[model samples]
Target: MVNTSFALSSTTRRRLSLVIGAYTVVVFATIVALGVLSATASDHAPRDAWVHAIIVAVFAILLPMRLRAASRGSLAGLRAIGIISGVLFMVNVVESTLSMFPVWMRTEMIVIALLMLVSIGLVVRERL
Candidate 1:
């Protein structure tokens, strides 16, 4: 059986929570803003709304899982998820920029970048 007994200091846990919460808020806000802007700029199509809904759903699920994983001291799991999320977020920004989406999307992209850096830092710090 795999030992899942990794534990984090209280301070570390709190810090991690702060980082995760900030990332989640920024991501969710960005999604809502994009959804609203898209609805306003384009005719409300089922497909567009569906895409937004899917993004929102993914954010909803991933954010909680991230928090839970961090709290449980699953550093490996958190880092893996963070890397995947960061890459996907960066891709989303690149696609949006290329597709002529509004400049406001950059805000979310920056947040994701910061989160990615912090996650990498956390992974490294935990190793020492």
Candidate 2:
């Protein structure tokens, strides 16, 4: 019985780790793609470009930390990051849509919003 319990616990840990790892990889890839798209654009507004760069940087920094938190079964830290990212993403979307931003800036905003939504979904799923 003890052996069975230990095995089950170990399996759960491994599964959690895999989920976190996958999430991190996806987030990092999305951020990098957005960053590249933003950096290469010629007609972006200065404000929009700055915002895009900042959001991408934040995601780049936070993805690994989020994975670590998830691996440790700490949902609070992930949730906090998700909420902040989501809010910033929404703000960027609104700004890019209403402002006279370039196509690349608009696309980058959309990408960031999607990334934030994915993070929120992952964190919620983990809680449930």
Candidate 3:
């Protein structure tokens, strides 16, 4: 049923949702582990680390809600999130590729870009 309407089949949607979910989990674990280490070891908080952690933490809460909306067949919501996340990831990928980030970081960016591109594909698939 999902496949008929979107580029992503139900299985693919489920898998991608799981991937996003896992990514969120990793975000939290990184924060907690880093936070604990920083608390015990550092006299002052690292501004950059805290900012990055907080941002990813927000994604931890938001992405699942968006995925739920998307999985529930909300076309408008899906399109909005899909396009926004897709373009954001695409831009990040290009930026990372051109930046001085190491090969591994660029590779990770590419992977995330692929996932978001699939999401965008699903959004556009509705019209095809």
Best by TM-score: 1
Candidate 1 weakest ten by summed lDDT: 44-53
Report the lDDT tens digits of candidate 3 across residue range 36-108. Answer: 7577854333544456457656766776787677677666556666666666566657655554443433454
Off by over 4 Å in 2: 1-42, 45-47
Rank by TM-score, highest first: 1, 3, 2
lDDT of candidate model 3 versus the reference: 0.60
Residue by residue across 68-105, what tens digits does model 1's lDDT show?
A: 77667776665655565566556555554542434455
Candidate 1 structure lDDT: 0.59
lDDT (10s digit) by residue, model 2, range 1-128: 22211111344345544544554554556456556655785353355455556555565566557556645555555556567656756776786586666675576567666666665565555556
Q: What is the TM-score of each predicted model, taking all chains together?
A: 0.65, 0.57, 0.61
Where does candidate 1 stray beyond 4 Å? 1-4, 43-60, 79-82, 85-99
